[model samples]
Target: MENQVFESSEERTFQYQSSLPSLPVPALDESLKKYLDAVKPFLNHKEYQRTEDIVKKFEHGIGKVLHHKLLERAKVKKNWLEEWWLNVAYLDARIPTQIYYNFGGPGPYLEHYWPPKEGTQIERGCIAIWHTLKYWELIRTEKVIVHRYGNMPLDMSQFRMIFCTCKIPGIPRDSLSNYFRTESEGECPSHLIVLCRGRVFAFDAVHEGHILSPPEIFRQLAYIQKRCHNEPDGPGLAALTSGERTQWAEIREYLTNLDPKNLSLLEKIQSSLFVISLDDSSPNGTPEDYTPITKLSLTGDPTIRWGDKSYNCIIFSNGTFGSNCDTFVADLSPCKRLLGQDLTLI
Candidate 1:
């Protein structure tokens, strides 16, 4: 089948959003039946019968009321699961978002380009960043082709949160913050945060309409690297972000009350486009290097990571890179695919 092209802004990407199917609410009896089946393995027949009886009562009574409420919610909101899922699966939970919610993986470029030389990191970072920014521009202009199943265009909402996004911790609950803006919409944040040895720095990555040249970016990175080398190790305060969210919230509040400047700094971290981690150790491996992804992205140096950022790129001293994505569902490879080797299908 020939691919459909959407040129007009409103007619493109999210044009079908209103027509998309609304999220479904499962039937009470059906869900109760599945619940019983799932718990059956852990119970004897008598116990199972007792459990079944309770479920039957609840299904016809309170469960029916709740299910009706859910269906009404589905009618009001096309994607009812978004908030509930995020709360239950992520925000409301106290577990750290690192390994529990986020996943890590290495770049596949090593398969074709091996033997990491000293200068290659800058070259590769330039290529990667340039491609990344271009992808964002496409999304901003509504030019990135939409993905569809049969005739329905899959939702492109999540793509916006991939950049210029971070999670903000609050009392009892945490919230997500997204600052992205299309060129037509408004100005987007064009600065990137660099985290090294628990310290952080920010620099403008965009020069005019283009991303900073490799030489410029390298110079900035080199400057930060030298400063870190000469100075005593930083407090690695970023690690607190990787700890339990509510605990982090308390620490964050203390820091805020401790000083106005500290509150401003926290706001800066939350508002930045994304974070770059200048890691201390280097782990060598093949193109499919899952080890470094684990070490660098999740368990390595917590000091160098901004755990709440939507995307955290960890660049090792050896020039390898791994991504620790705050949101587990996002796949950054599409940014590569939109710029790299042609894709098979949308």
Candidate 2:
């Protein structure tokens, strides 16, 4: 077997640099004012003052750093600061103005906070905000808006919103609480709208029939790890344990002999392999239900051959559907060799 290689620091830097495009002066429009008004109430809410202050402070510091970097990049040209202002205006028009925190339950309970329920498209606003914040340096802003809404079925008593000295719109009056429903799936149409440079964008807490969050993904990962431990002769394991033997002991022994870093690689490969098999056997032929599986492989150098024909392997990732024959056909190549057979026999 050949050793797997990782990219070098210079290679990684080059890749990162290649992905970024040259900064362009984006247009500012009246829609930005509308977006600001839409998100004002949440930003100015008393509950979120502290968080808002902190974020503003961070943004200010980051903006200063970016200004210096950009100035140097442009050879200290006059009016270079104007470029930064344009970037900031562009971002302000797109990003949200508040961040909502969950306030449900007695002790330490927090729910998923989405956007406002009415008068705006929440998903679009959220994505715009995300993009602005992510590219803040390139698109500078003194203050950024982040609309926060509590998760459904969860109480909003502890919910908090953070913002600067911005006023929220009152005309399209609506509460963040009223937008989302407690349904198990589908988009909430009445969610808050995000206006960016006069263009409207929307976002929904519901994605692919479920809500998105970091904790949810972490829980799923833990479940998969536990299942892997309990099942003796599991997909990757070649043996089983009895009453006198503990599975943990076998795992420990295996770890001792293998490189620690390879463990992650092995897990990734094993998880992907499992998804491929599971998808192939599914009655509905869809992998959306398998959220824990991240990647799948259908064909590779490791081919399985039967008689005169060779079958290629298939691969997939989470959020991917096996029914998409176009993706499979486009990604995979035909296998020309056979497994458990002599190459000359073909």
Candidate 3:
């Protein structure tokens, strides 16, 4: 479905949030029956019968109590399992997020006019950045249309993490840092971060109360690229994000303590709208053969990618594009869909 922007006072993107139904807790009996069905293939007749007996016992005893507690929780919370799911599935994982937990894919433009063309990286990247900022504006103004399943509108809260969000590491578990806010809610971060040649640069996407046009963004990107080519590389602090979660957390804390300014710099990256990675490698692969591109996008340059950021747009030297993003923010499908629509804007 095509996304429509609604500028009228009566319509807004998140209008359905309040009216949407809360997530429900399934019955214990239903869950137990599904568990039995799942285990049947793995167990023989005797083993299956013994496992079934244990499951039935639990279903009648502690399972009923836990289910009742969950039902009580659902009564108070809109989505009872959201925080638990995020923690268990993402934040608490100790593996390197870059190649393991994060998701990436080949650029959507590969099937169309934009292909691997050397020296076009900054120019095409500026256009993509401009459209991405426009998408941010649509969300800020509440003009973007709400997504629906049939007549029912789905929750749009996760859209906030699409911009101005980062995942911060901790000792026991990581945490999400989100600075997104609609115009009616409050002010939000409008700065952009560019990662090139192991150096980090920040600039305001909104200048003089308006988002910069493609030409303006191109000037900024071109300047960063040129400086990166001319000068010595800055410390690749971003590579820390590719390490194990607890290790990254300790290193980040050490850096912060080494210099108070380091904490400010970290905040800048965490609060920026999103990251634009200017990659030097060009994985020249067509849409029909995306293996090369996908591999590089997910695992190529640790120095150039902030593995924990909610979104990172990777612009290769040949003008091809790919994205590496933390799954904790949102899944790849919706981001891909949004990028597809953003390309139409371009």
Highest TM-score scorer: 3
TM-score per candidate, in order? 0.84, 0.21, 0.92
Number of the top candidate by lDDT?
A: 3
Q: Flag the better candidate by lDDT, 1 or 2.
A: 1
Q: Which residue segments of model 3 deviate by more than 4 Å?
A: 1-10, 331-346
Candidate 1, residue 2: CA error in Å? 12
- Candidate 1 per-residue C-alpha lDDT over 1-346 given as tens digits, one digit per residue, 9 for 90 to 100: 3245444454555456677788788878788889998999999999999999999899889888898889989988988888888877778878887657776767533645644445455456655666666666677677867777776678777777878888877768888878887666788877777787667776767765677666667766777777777877778878888888888999888888887878877766777767778776766756555675566667788888878888887776666677787873371242321121110110
Residue lDDT tens for model 3, 111-139: 57897899999889999989899989988
Q: Tell how far residue 76 is off in model 2, in angstroms.
A: 14
**True lDDT of residue 28, candidate 1:** 80
Supply the TM-score for candidate 2.
0.21
Instruction: Return whichever of 1 and 3 wins on lDDT.
Output: 3
Worst window of 10 by summed lDDT in candidate 2: 337-346
Work out how many backbone clashes candidate 1 has.
0
